[model samples]
Target: MSSNDLEICKRFAAERAVLDREFKGNVVVGIGSGSTVVYVTKCIAETITRMNKEAEKDGRKPDLNVTCIPSSFQAKELILRNNLNLGSLESFPLVDWTIDGADEIDSQNNIIKGGGGCHTQEKILASCSKELYIVGDYTKYSPKLGTNWKKGIPIEVIPVSYVAVKRKIECRLGGEVLLRMAVMKAGPVITDNSNFIVDWRFPEGIDNWKDIETTLKMIPGVVEVGLFIKMAIKIYIGNEKDVKIYDFSPSNE
Candidate 1:
């Protein structure tokens, strides 16, 4: 986020994907959580404004009544900052699309998310949407799930039951679960919903992601797990040289 060139390139990938892709009948969009989404929301606002101006010139009303539903508080801030029409999932339950970021992804399109501790909401948005697009730099995609990113899975839990959830994960899921501590604030990091986070990392890393995610979610206090299986319909991978987009059908663009 500082003056890093890589971060800037990622911004291009995020913005370019939304700018280039056609959202023909998409009126309601689910905005996701991450640095990349910051650019995506801005582009949406810009495009909407441009469309409105063009419509006015043609003596017709602006028709792209795009409404953005944010996944988290940070995402909500981005939506408001861009001067876009803000909406909620309750109103727009079935979204046209959802764009999000991933910490790590594999050949099967499985992903490890929630480095931002917003995976709970991120997953919900993706699950609720008709299509989910994963956006990031080329570095995010890996041959194996844990080989590139081994930072562990992020799990949001109820604060009062964090201790029990941590123990359950370590005992049943075979990983070391640590209560996520706040780097900028005192004590544990609290989510927008006022829940606690527990990041679990297996010393050897994960292979059966779906099973692991299911096990973690079975715990009484666990709210959500960071492992995402077969949720993304497409991925936009960007490099300094060029950007590549991959779909679940093994096609590229």
Candidate 2:
């Protein structure tokens, strides 16, 4: 296969190999929404089939029943397409693992997600997991999240609250905020749930990011911010040569 084809398949295969080793029998998995994580779902499907085939050859029933929880409508569709079992948040309270991608990851391991407009559900699914693993390419790693993911912080809000929420982010917070327009193919870029997205920007050299995140969340119209703080347990980075894993344990640096 060519490099372009290799890039698409190789990265997903590497991530799948890691996940297959981590997930054994009867695992509860969270499927995150994004282009990179789409490969993750595909990997899970192949792994499940391999396990089932192995059991058939041994004349034994496979106990590797995988239940997948989706972070978005796109994720839900992928789950069904892969022939994997599906469950809702209300049905499965806890997940064994969550595999996701990030917009950016810093030294602290805090991330910026929501590039697919599924920030709210992604956050919920990630928190429900026992261990959350982020799978992505080297381009996503950054000194800070907003530094590389210059798309700005994606904030999901109630439809009626868009105007008020925009003012709070731009005026009250003294930062730049803009209403995300529908550029993909339409009048407005409506989300799966028909909610609007507002991207917020802070000064280039922001000192207190945590404080800013806290302040923006306090706004009434805001539903959820894209700043994912202390959610990932480990990150599996896909470099050109190989895949490297990083733990989110406490560290001075």
Candidate 3:
């Protein structure tokens, strides 16, 4: 297949190999919102369809019922496109596995996501999954978090409380805050749940990001931030030839 970058295809292939090899039986799959995760979603649907067809050819049919819960609207569309079974978070609170794409990943496997503006829901789904795997190209990897992908942290804030939240981030926190505007859409960049997005940037040389994360969450208007602290179970860093996987655990800290 033709692609803009050969590495994209390789990353998709590697993720598929891992999922097909590991993920089996009645699995509640979590579909993440992003270009890279798109491939993983496609693989899940393809595997289900293939299994169904194989069962039809045999004397007995099989029930390859893989219920998928999506992270965002984009994810929902992908699931429908593949003719995969759809389930809601309330229906399927626990996911067998989740594969997502990251904007940046640290050595400790912490991630900075929501580049697509699905941070809040993504974080919830990622946290609920029994195993969360992040997929990205070599550019998303860093010795430490917040090195590359410098669009700041994507913060989900209440629509009515945007101004106060912005002030708290800019004036109180001494950071830069930008309300994400709408370009293609009519109104502001509305999330799947119709929430506004605010991108916040802080100064470099921070020892404890956990403190900053805590402070942001304490803000009344702030719903959630893109800083995925210790939520990733594994991350696949796509490079030339093969993909490198990093295991995240508190024991490493």
User: In terms of TM-score, which candidate is strongest?
Assistant: 1
Error in Å for residue 231 of model 1: 0.4
- In model 1, the clashing pairs are none
How are the candidates ranked when ordered by lDDT, highest leading? 1, 3, 2
Q: If ranked by TM-score, best first, what sequence of candidates would result?
A: 1, 2, 3
Please, what is the TM-score per model?
0.91, 0.89, 0.89
- Tell me which of candidates 1 and 3 scores higher on TM-score: 1
Report the lDDT tens digits of candidate 3 across residue range 1-253: 2455645754654464446435456778888888787777777766777777888899656766688899999999998988888998999999988878878888865678888999889989988899887887777889886688678889999999999999988876776888998998776798887889998877677646677789999999888899987787777776655677676745654
Query: Which digits, one per residue and each the tens of the lDDT, describe model 2 over residues 1-253?
Result: 4557536544753465346455566778888877777788888888888878999999999878789999999989999998889988899989988888877888777788877788888988888988788877767788776767888888888788888998877787666877788776765456666788888876677656677779878998777788888777777777666776777845622
Per-residue error for 188 in candidate 3, Å, reads 2.6
lDDT value for model 2? 0.78
- What shift in Å separates residue 104 of candidate 2 from its native position after superposition? 1.2
Q: Which candidate do you rate higher for TM-score, 2 or 3?
A: 2
